[model samples]
Target: MTVRAGREFLAIPGPTTMPDEVLQAMHRPALDIYSREMVELTETLLAELSKLFATKGQSYIYIANGHGAWEATLSNVLSRGDKVLVLESGRFAIGWGSAATAMGADVEVLKGDWRRAIRPAEVEARLRQDKDHKIKAILAVQVDTASGVFNDIEAIGKVIKECGHPALFMVDTVASLGCMPFEMDKWGIDVAMSGSQKGLMTPPGLGFVAASDRAREVHKTANMRTPYWDWTEREGPEHYRKYAGTAPVHLLFALRQAVNMLLAEGLENAFLRHRLLAEAVRRAVAVWAEGQVLGFNVAEAHERSNTVTTVVMNGNDPVSLHRYCKEKCGVVLGVGIGDLQGQAFRIAHMGHVNAPMILGTLSVIEVALKALDIPHGKGGAEAAIEWLGESVGA
Candidate 1:
């Protein structure tokens, strides 16, 4: 009962719809890995990545996922018994803490509600109590993908400095890198890690780790890391050492194309686009939430994420709605995770998404709600459209 004519919409938070330019950029004959063209590409990729992460310090490319990037960041700077304080706002942050635990580091978690951001005061309090500064690193995620909550990393860095804690400030920017503004050097982030699939608008095979001079110094006497994940060797002599071995040449092409597109559009316009699209999507959700059994998982609108909006269904099956939207309509919505699973669903408004795409998605969701007999307010799509018009006008 499904017809396949139009373009299939994939609205997941990561591995978003690929840009035609990026796809075409990767469509080429395989080049010699040691050739001048390939070396130039590798260098350009590193240079542009530094710009994207806003860190002038050393940045490394890895043929791995965000999780591997996590390991690289940890192993590069942390010793076996190092004590790292982790801030847990959602699943990914907790996952990082788990990695630290497995790596034999003592992890102290500062927990926060899934809906709220990390409180800087709590962080400051913890650091102040540690007068001797047993904590070696402060681990945090800029945007936790599961709960769609963003922490004020810059403010937290300020708090760390105010407390005079010498712990390294490490941030995971997997879901928020190019989609939002991340000033790594400006915020004094010792280490910043991210993946290729999210805001970078590439496929999911690459992860990045950017380190400050202080963090790189820690690597000199760090834990025993595997040959591949060791940043020292990767950052050592020879161009091939950067990737540890043969590079993911095609993925490198995609990354180069993605970074070029980002720089071409300018980061300011990119952030503004994501912000406007997120507001419009929330506007539509608010309209639909009027008298229906619908609500936003995040309580405050301002607290909501520009990356994705988690929608809660009061009396309906989120699975059924998600399935209907996928099967009946040509739209793919992200599933809720962890704490909100099955009770809620998510809509991604991140990279490579536009007004038409969001509008179409809202319309399809409205249709699915109606067909599935779920109670939802009318004119949700209209509200989104209205907001889009107003944003364009402004």
Candidate 2:
């Protein structure tokens, strides 16, 4: 008989394990939509959200997912036929650009090596070539979770400044925010978008957008603005505009608790912890790769993401490996998406994950590799243990 025990571990890149504090915060009954308590929660939550993004600019919360945030951002800043320079580092950025296209925005994508981060020099050169300044915005992902590659958003911003480009700098931090160092204001990001599920340690259904004064100013002249996504109307003094109507009361409570936990732990500490865990995972993967059957999808070490690690299986079938781990070991792993389908898998080391949790995931993966006779070097778990033991914190 197949036997499995203990809590099933979810190691997917998104919809990460939520902290008990957040779950408990959302467990209660919904509050009155217009009550003073709700108003206070809304005020405190928006203020803290601003601090979370490291921005003094206005932030709006929506009862939508990251896709909605992408659409909302496009509508708020671009009009029909406006030009946007999209940096295609991976699948998601292209998806964002496609959303812009659907909104009647003209998108010019800079095809990049899928395995590496976008080169700042290339961005600078491209912007310099646009002497007429036709590009209204440059859209990129801080970390392309699909490829497990992290781009330097700050470097991109600096390049834009070097070229003297007036285009708005926009970044999608859906997978990187709270897991890594992302300073929206410090990075000179005119607009930034993120979702609640990944690094925020909250349930899905909440989308966040932090807009600088320039992005808001663009909103005034932006012809594509719709009532639901109009930044001015949403950010107005009216309490009803907070959610464009009644608020997602319980989500606000959960977010408040999650933000409190993150602040208490300190954002830097959180980033370091995620970095250390990701390194441990990498070390383990390195050992496994010694058998020459496994390899990293991302070729460059510096470009690797701190939130997720995508592993190439060479000739092995990723679907079978994922199925074995889920059914036999009760460890859920992220399936490869886009170009990586059937060939790669992902290990997420973000959100509320800790050493023991990651160690358990590594151990299970090692066992599955052996059980399935997948060619892998011995001692992957040992390598992970050694690396994790060397440092108490990062």
Candidate 3:
């Protein structure tokens, strides 16, 4: 076995590689939480974050993960017996339902297969069935990381509008934030949640929520209110009181820098880059799956996520190939989570990922597949090469 060395590439869906600019920005010594510089930095971040989310609504930053954001959003808008509709495409949707259930809310799950996205027609059907309109909120993830499925949030939003349902549209964009084209305000999304790990190109430490005035009003009248997760106190006059205590100084530093880098590249350019990068991976996998090797978990091309590609190994053990690619070739691929465990692998092309990095990952996977006697087509790598032939800086 030949040992490979250099930079060990970490290509998982979240906790993506941080840009040099963000790292450098975070390297400096911590500042006083109430310092003028800190205040300015925080203000800048909050203002710019709203733009990044494509929301003109209010934004709040928290020192937690994506799960924490879920809890905060649920607690803020729900009363004890409020009915919430969870649109399920994969694991994350179910997780949201469970969280709402635990919070003493009745959750109605509109289930879907892992291979496809949530159907707008199904959402309409459910809304139509709720003649009394008991559903208070519609919870969903724009991109489900587990199955690599991208739902049509815009179309679903349109359905909700047509139904005239009085439900808040809450979206989890932890995986899709900066990597995909998400227009929270344009799509009529009431509340949008995200984490710093995936698309912000930062180390994981922060969770963000962008809420509309209506959501804020609902939060003001919510049950089981806690001082910490309360959005009103967080947005009050005493800015330091928002965090409830001392802030995560270094993480804030990283976030400020990360958001800056994203803005520098521009959101439109970011979306285009993510789309092209994802297509390159899809081209490789589609051609490879032709010979009965590896195929995408999401069946439809339009429904697949631009952030990550979940690949099913048919009857083959994907774990073995994943290990070979990591230990032998220095590429760390993501293992399948939830139901697809041991049967599939994921390739993340979101946030700070480029053509050379993608090509490097693909080359190693092809070599490992052949070494393991895995049945696959010969030109998967070539296909990706041709896709990038035009340009990567596109």
**Candidate 1 regions off by >4 Å?**
1-4
Highest-TM-score candidate = 2
TM-score of 3: 0.98
**Residue-level lDDT tens digits of model 2 in 329-381:** 88999988999988899999999999998999999999899988999989988
lDDT of each: 0.88, 0.92, 0.89
lDDT of 3 by residue, 88-156 (tens): 999998898899999899988997899999999999999999999899999999999999999999999
lDDT of 2 at 305: 96
Which 10 consecutive positions of candidate 3 have the poorest summed lDDT? 385-394
Clashing pairs in 2: none
| TM-scores of all candidate predictions against the true structure | 0.97, 0.98, 0.98
Q: Kindly state the number of residue pairs that clash in model 3.
A: 0
Model 1 accuracy (lDDT, Cα)? 0.88
